[model samples]
Target: MAITIELDDAMASQLRSEAAARQMSLEEFGRRLLAEAMHRIQVSSNWRARNQRRVELIRKSTSAELTAAEQAELDDLQAELYERMETADQDLLDRIADLENTVMP
Candidate 1:
């Protein structure tokens, strides 16, 4: 699908500069960014589903002991969730810095 959208001059210039820095055309860079964003959305959805299962497992544990496999799965899920949170936190921080640089500089 092809879509056309208007961007302010500053935004357009910034994107062009970034694309140049990566040695890619603006269109290619934009496509790559969109693909990355879609991947992130899918990852977030998967995380939500895993979180729900984690909650269910914890609730079950409170009522009765989990089997060995269930316990291991819970541990793995917790670690994966923590890693995702850390990565997300870092991404937010990086975006904030980028925005600050754009606005203040």
Candidate 2:
């Protein structure tokens, strides 16, 4: 897919300066930044799906009582999901700060 974005002259100049500082063209910089953001989103989404499945399984086994191993697995999944969600949230905030730094005076 191809997309076009229109940036004001001032913003463009700032982006150019940042690109030069990193020794990359603006296009390459944008692509790399966007790819990282997208990967984070994908990971978060996958974790959400896995978390939901674990929740469903726990619910299904609630009436019958889960074995120790099953309970341990669910606990592990919940912990991992929490960590992943926290990381994703932090990544988003960090990315926002980075973009703000680039555009803000």
Candidate 3:
């Protein structure tokens, strides 16, 4: 697929600088950026879907009983969700520290 976009001068300059720093063509860098974004979107979508299923399973368990397999799946989903939350929290803290250092230095 081919697409053309008109970027404002600042954005264009930034992208060009980044591509040069990476020793890549602007088009290749743009493609890589888009691919990374799409991958993140897909990962987020899958996480949401898993979370929905986990909620449903929890509701079912509260009202009735889960099979052994269902219980295992719920446990796995809960663990994964907790880990992701922890990672996100740490990332936020790291970014905040970076900003503070830049501002205070």
Candidate 1 residue lDDT tens string, 1-105? 889979999999999999999999999999998899999899889988999999999999999999999999999999988898899899999999999999999
For model 3, residues 22-104, the per-residue Cα lDDT tens digits are: 99999999999989999999999999999999999999999999999999999999999899999999999999999999999
User: For residues 1-105, could you state the per-residue lDDT of candidate 2 as single tens digits?
Assistant: 888889899988998898899999999988887899999799879977888879876896878888888788888898887887798899999999999999994
Candidate structures ordered by TM-score, highest first: 3, 1, 2
Q: After superposition, how far is residue 59 of candidate 3 from its true place, in Å?
A: 1.6
Model 3 alpha-carbon miss at residue 77, Å: 0.7
**Steric clash pairs (candidate 1):** none
Q: Which stretches in model 3 have alpha-carbon errors above 4 Å?
A: none
* Each model's backbone clash number: 0, 0, 0
Candidate 1 Cα misplacement greater than 4 A, ranges: 89-105
RMSD of each: 3.4, 5.5, 1.7
- Give the Cα lDDT of each candidate: 0.95, 0.86, 0.97
Q: Global CA lDDT of candidate 3, please?
A: 0.97
lDDT of residue 69 for candidate 2? 82
TM-score of 1: 0.74
